[model samples]
Target: MIPQNIVKQNILDAIAVIHKEGVPKERESTKYHLWYNGGLYPPKYVISVANRFANGHALSRDRFNGGAETNNFLKRLGFEVIEETLATKNEMQMSEEQTFRVGEYYSRNDIYQKLNVPKAKQKGHWNTGYTQYEKDSFIFANVGTAGRTGHDHPNRFDGNDLIWYGRNKSTLTQSSIQSLINPEGRTYIFAREDSNDPKFLFLGNGRAKDYFDESPVKIIWSFDNETENHPEILAEEVNELEIYTEGSVKKVSVNVYERNPIARKKCIEHYGLGCQVCGFNFVNIYGIIGENFIHVHHLKPLHEISEKYEIDPVEDLRPICPNCHAMLHKRKPAYSIEELKRIIKDKVTDTPH
Candidate 1:
């Protein structure tokens, strides 16, 4: 069976890729800003490079311009390319499985090249959001800083975001694993091995620990263990001993660390404690009382429980002001702040008055 820790770590890794390389942002209404320093290039060039380095097949002009050229460049650097289009009547559909496969392919190959870097004297810090135990226990086995090295550095752009490169795997105690699985009474997305389907499994829950003997998850870092800096993966070896029937592995609630107090404070500092949803500037409204105000909210919900029962803070909390918080839970079943904003916007746009 695919280990639970590996599944969660992979999901986090995938999310990071999506956030960094999914697409470009626009300024005002006119200028388009690509994530990399390079501005816009032709579609063909981009596609070509992507195809070469990371086996990316579908290159959409509307979504990704210059995809062809990108694929070609990657090929020159030594990477596989896979291109296949679905036969949808109107919109072209690409499977998440395929997208994730491309990401995994690039990540694995990148690790191969990163293994060449000289080991660092001190290990990098681990940010588990609780005690420093997890960070201290980290041992970089192989791999180097994700981007700054080798033939493994594939130019795989999800949209305009840079997909970092490197790999490292490590083990975490069951206690630590519990904290990660269901931090602060919420669940997060994770990956696991499907007993029925050996391909892969995507799950969101706390039951992931049952797959392991001692440690809950085996993390594979993309950077060298000696250096200790960089993201790591939680993985397990797939062998005959782990095989099981379908439904034997089930999804349960678990906590995840996406945002914490420090992160929330940073966002408030950047946005000046204003409600991004309603444009309510706290300072202007409440004066001095609102000085260090504003609450942070998580875009995703975390699971409240796990198999082992662990309590974590970082994975389940977000900051937000009371007004916004109330608004979030105002309706029956509640609505996300973003969802509320969209609903309000639509209502106004359609109003005759």
Candidate 2:
């Protein structure tokens, strides 16, 4: 177990390093600096932070030697660090000219490779492993003028579903669309309203017609064009229909509560099945493992509220191990997430002077 003082000091040191070495690049845009594009903090600062934390550790393998040390140190500090192994410098760069590369998109193979775990080789080709919620979360995080445009493209295996919204759609073409897909796989293309040359195009990852004569191809075109309202009929004239020999179809269902489950799981996973509000790990508090469950409580009751309003789970949920959960409401109303986090931070600071 890491000492509380050590954790606090390390975090402070990391922040200090970030402030000093992580000086914003003069050429880089202010927005990029603010967002910590490519990865959080500058590469130099990240390395500094990692070196400070990993000063004495057997696992200080050189595998993370080239600025990857930050990820390792963050992992040690009980934060989930998702490094984009597949993204190249150019792809991940936050410059205005930066564009999405085929490799930047995460796939099942990418996930397996990153996890360093082997599984049965996937037969089908797919672009991204992100669920609907994950995709929407990404969109929400980068919305409006502040958000960069033209990053929203469908993955391979999606059959002509143009659900994405973006700016400057006129530049898109059949050839331009093909460049988005690599030789290894295909990608889904969502037509935008901004494009004057409106035509339904499904770029890659479709079965051969011999495999299946009739496959359900769902195509959504912009409502801006009343004539293009019938996408299925319009697609037939262009022979945009394609078949998949052995590929999986990606489906996205919109739900009211998107990030709640993810936040809950993350809290449990990060805190090690323990309550952050009160230091109650399952084994430490309860002898029976079965009884040692952590419950996620929403700061604002979600179900009671109507679906018309959008709620952010990050601002709402608190993970309390079963013991803390019971004790929290024993007398007064349950504490808000902010209150709980403050209490936990205080407890950690106050321990042993």
Candidate 3:
């Protein structure tokens, strides 16, 4: 058996690896296996925090009978061992929610009403349609005609979507004419596929100056348009292109970073650095090295966010330890703090010595 201290370090290292590289695949276990002095350490290891049993080693089976002592040790360190894998359920829910949130899975006929296309203008094969106006800013919807705006017109292709040439002065005035006698220079361009696939794909802010000089206007489609640098242009141009062309219909997944600094700080401030599940305090164990150090977990899985919702950090977040946090996320929806507490109770009851 590995020394208790080394085992503890190994566990901590494994948790860190999970935080950095995500859950390791079954085949990739050796890649993340604990190693010391160039030799394989922790001969019996937990393959995945998300999976309970696949590689033959009992995840909950530990030194103590019924693994109570092991469970207790992990709990004290702020971790829990899960019993099943339910990440798929959570992922399926998230997939549906993401599709709905980004306006991707709407029906073909509803595309016109969903995009707020004018009733009188909905009958024709007009390549461009006007959507809603926000604060007097016009939002234009262009149905990509396989890179064709007019008969034999020059087109700029960017993956599956077409970048119709920019508008100059008189042309700009003509494009802005809605016959409602309301023309706004500030415009937003949203793109939809051809009439065959009428689902809107992109939304972008357009400025007259960018188009006045014939600067290439890439169609706006990705919802992840905001970035630290440029807020208007494609935040991740290449990645967005891939998503727009081929990736969106595939298994698109959101990478949820559980470590929310704002939420973490708020949780720690409200509850202190003590683990809410097992009352473990890192500073009490390791002195200055662990001061003000505690892992904050969202009571609700971060991957389930579908819209802009306010999270009350104190109520929605809690400070736990690495072990407990891992255990919480072991299952798809994650275990509640109260549920983990009950697991500790049951383990204590099972272990007499």
- Summed backbone clashes in each candidate are 86, 8, 6
Looking at candidate 2, the ten consecutive residues that score lowest on lDDT are 136-145
Ranking by lDDT: 3, 2, 1
lDDT of 2 by residue, 32-111 (tens): 11112123343323433444664643222343433344444444555333333223233334222322211123333434
Indicate which candidate wins on lDDT. 3
> Which regions of candidate 1 fall more than 4 Å away from where they truly are?
1-260, 304-320, 331-334, 347-353
State residue 301's C-alpha deviation in candidate 2, in Å. 2.7
lDDT of 3: 0.44
**What lDDT does the true structure give each of the candidates?**
0.32, 0.34, 0.44
Clashing pairs in 2: 155-188, 162-190, 206-243, 206-244, 207-243, 207-244, 207-245, 208-243
* Alpha carbon RMSD to native, model 3: 20.9
lDDT of 1: 0.32
Runs in model 2 deviating more than 4 A are: 1-109, 112-124, 128-260, 266-276, 283-293, 302-304, 327-353
Displacement of residue 173 (Cα, Å) in model 1 is 32
